[model samples]
Target chain A: MRKISAEKIIAVISRLCIQSNCQINEDLITSLKHARGKEQGRARMVLASILKNIKIAQREKLPVCQDTGMAIVFLEIGDKLKIDLGEFLSLSALVQEGVRRGYQSGYLRKSIVEPLSRVNTEDNTPAIIREKIVAGNRLKIKLLIKGFGAENMAKTSMLRPDAGEAGIKRFTLDSVKKAGSHPCPPMVIGIGIGGTMQKAVSLAEEALLEPVKSKRAYFRGCPGLKSKIKRLEEELLREINQLNIGPAGLGGETTALSVKIKTFPTHIAGLPVAVNISCWANRHQEIIL
Target chain B: MKTKRIFAPLTSEGIKKLETGDEVLLSGIIYTARDAAHQRMTKNLKKLPFDLKGQIIYYTGPTPPSPGKIIGSCGPTTSYRMDPYTPSLLKLGLKGTIGKGERSQEVKEAIKRYSAVYFIAFGGCGALYSQFIKKTTLIAYLDLGCESILKLEVEDFPLLVGIDACGRDIYQQQKT
Candidate 1:
């Protein structure tokens, strides 16, 4: 068994919280540049400002957006890996400690609030953690800092099994159209198809972590299923951009930078679909130990 | 495409001249207030931190500044959240507001009724916007942390006139 120290895990999570919020990933930067090239008028101007903001954030070691966002941590632990939980009751406590330290030290905003009382959780604690056990002995930690602007626009639907792909397409397009400019334009669209309602939503959130137009080779399914998903992603990207919501929704040909879809097998009688929209600053980072 | 330079504490004539889609470089003082502060201010109108006459409120809740920085990543939040409280503030002679996203028809009509303007700072451009903010002073609601009312002195802040005093809305104009 490979033992990972609690201290190491906490330190890594802390660093990731700060790093992910401050840095714009290369793939997203490239996608934004491509979108900028295709934009004109106000859209072009918005893109220019966004690109400059990314640079300033990096140079100054500041968050790309003021809404540092709620931390969503994904941990894939290897079956053979064991965590030494020193002084902490569980792995989750360590993760939350990391987030608290990171947000405090990084000067990131404390955005999470008690839903009903609307009181701020000053240190940005209790991150949403998703864990899975995989085959290898390596531990992989992925952090997605989700801002509320786009998150508020997320949607899920239980479509009829007969509805199939066409249903998903219509639902996604309608959601984006209805969203208009609120979620911030040139957004990244994450779609989850199949699975139960909550599972589909989680899958969509996971899809946002994938780099734009990048293929996932690890999908376990039929031989051609991966390619089929890729094709659908491309089609969705095309149609979403054609909406003309544009950059900042001021009007242009580049409304969405990318559309990623993740699928899982569901009950034969039910088809669940969920859409998670992320703003241009789709902040996420991963580390493997 | 021509950039018009304007100062805050906006004048009625100045606001009246601005049309939808006019690019503006705003300087001078504006105040920052987001959802929490807005709710508090609108709820207790008798004890406002400052006079609303001719002032602009930026709908933003910036990250805490790092050491030696005037402010952290500071950009516009969605404007529509403040739609409920906006007409009242506009009625109180608030000259303009800065935020991102479309406003309701009620707010647009109120803008016309009160001869106020609405400007949009580039959404998600927090880091870029930070450079324009010269100074920030906490004005009220200290308990709200980042959502506290702050008096910010800005210089050459980029903005696009979204809704002008005449009720012309850039969002509506651009959509068609």
Candidate 2:
């Protein structure tokens, strides 16, 4: 078994929290630059302003957005890996500790609150963590700072088996239209297809971490399925951008920057789809150990 | 269509002159309030530490200040989250609000009826906007952390008139 210090985990998480917030990921920056070239009028101005904002935030090491967002951490742990820690009995406690330390030390806003009572947690602890066991001895961690503006616009549906590809496309388009200016267009769409409702939602959330326009090699061995899914993603991207919602919803040619789709096996009777949107300031980071 | 410079304690004439798609460089004092602060203020308007009449509210929940800085990255939150409570506040003589995203029809109507204007700062440009804020003072609802009410002194703060008092709305214009 490979043993890792939980303190190291805390340090990594703390750094990733600050890093993800203060800097726009390079892939997202690349996408924005591409969008800027294609946009016009007020949308072009908006994109230019966004680019300027990113530069300033980077120079000063400030968060790109005020919301700071809820920290969602994904942990891919090897079956042979074990953690050594003092007060924390479970992996979750270690993760929460990391979040608490990260938010406080990084000067991030404490956004998590007690849902019903409406009291602030103060440290932004208890991150939404999804842990999975895989084959190697290495551990991989991905942290996504999900701002509420885009998150509030997420849509999900459990479609009938007969709904098929066209139905899914229609649902996605309808969501983009209804969302309009609220989610901070141009948006990066993360879609999860198949599986149960909750599973699809989780998949959608995980898919946001993938680099823009990158493909999943899970079905690489079966080129037919892979190519089909790739085509669907491309079509969704094209259709979403045609919405003309523009940057900050000011009306322009580029409504969305990218559409990433991840799918899973589902029950024969069910076809669940989830759309998780990310604003242009797509903030996320990864750490490998 | 044109960038205009305006000071706070906005007059009815000033509100009327503002139109959709107009750029603004707003100066003077503005109050900060987000979801929790708005909820509490709407529930107990009398308990508010500051006057609502003719004051502007910026819908923001800022990150804690980094050492020696006056304020941290501060930007507008989505306006729709406060839609349910906006009409009540507008009726109390609140002259304007600054936030990102489109307001609801009810909010747009309330802005017209109350002779108020709605402005939007660049969404996600918190760091850039922070440069405009001269000072920030915690005004009320301290227990709410970032969502606490804050009074801010600003100069040349950039905004776009999203909805004007005459019922002209930039967001609606964009849809067509």
> lDDT by residue for model 1 over A20-115, one digit each (tens)?
999989999998898788777788989999999999999998899999999999999999999999999999999999899999999999998888
Q: Over the stretch B1-176, how does candidate 2's per-residue lDDT look in tens digits?
A: 56899999788888878888998999999999988888888878777778899999999999988998888889888899999999999999999999988888999999999999999987888988998999999978888889888999999999999999988889879887
Off by over 4 Å in 1: A217-220
Error of 2 at A285 (Å): 0.6
DockQ of 2: 0.83
Worst lDDT run of 10 residues, candidate 2 chain A, spans A214-223
* Residue pairs whose backbone atoms clash in candidate 1: none
DockQ of 1: 0.84
Across A1-289, the per-residue lDDT of candidate 2 in tens digits comes to: 8999989998999999999999998888888899899887789888888888899888877888887899999999998887788778988999999889988998898899889997778899779999999998888999999998999889999999889999999999998888888877888888888889998898888878889858662342344877788899899888887887889999987888888888888889989999999988888999899
TM-score of chain B of each: 0.98, 0.97
TM-score of 1: 0.98
Candidate 2, residue A275: how far the Cα is off, in Å = 0.8
Give me the displacement of residue A52 in model 2, in angstroms: 1.4
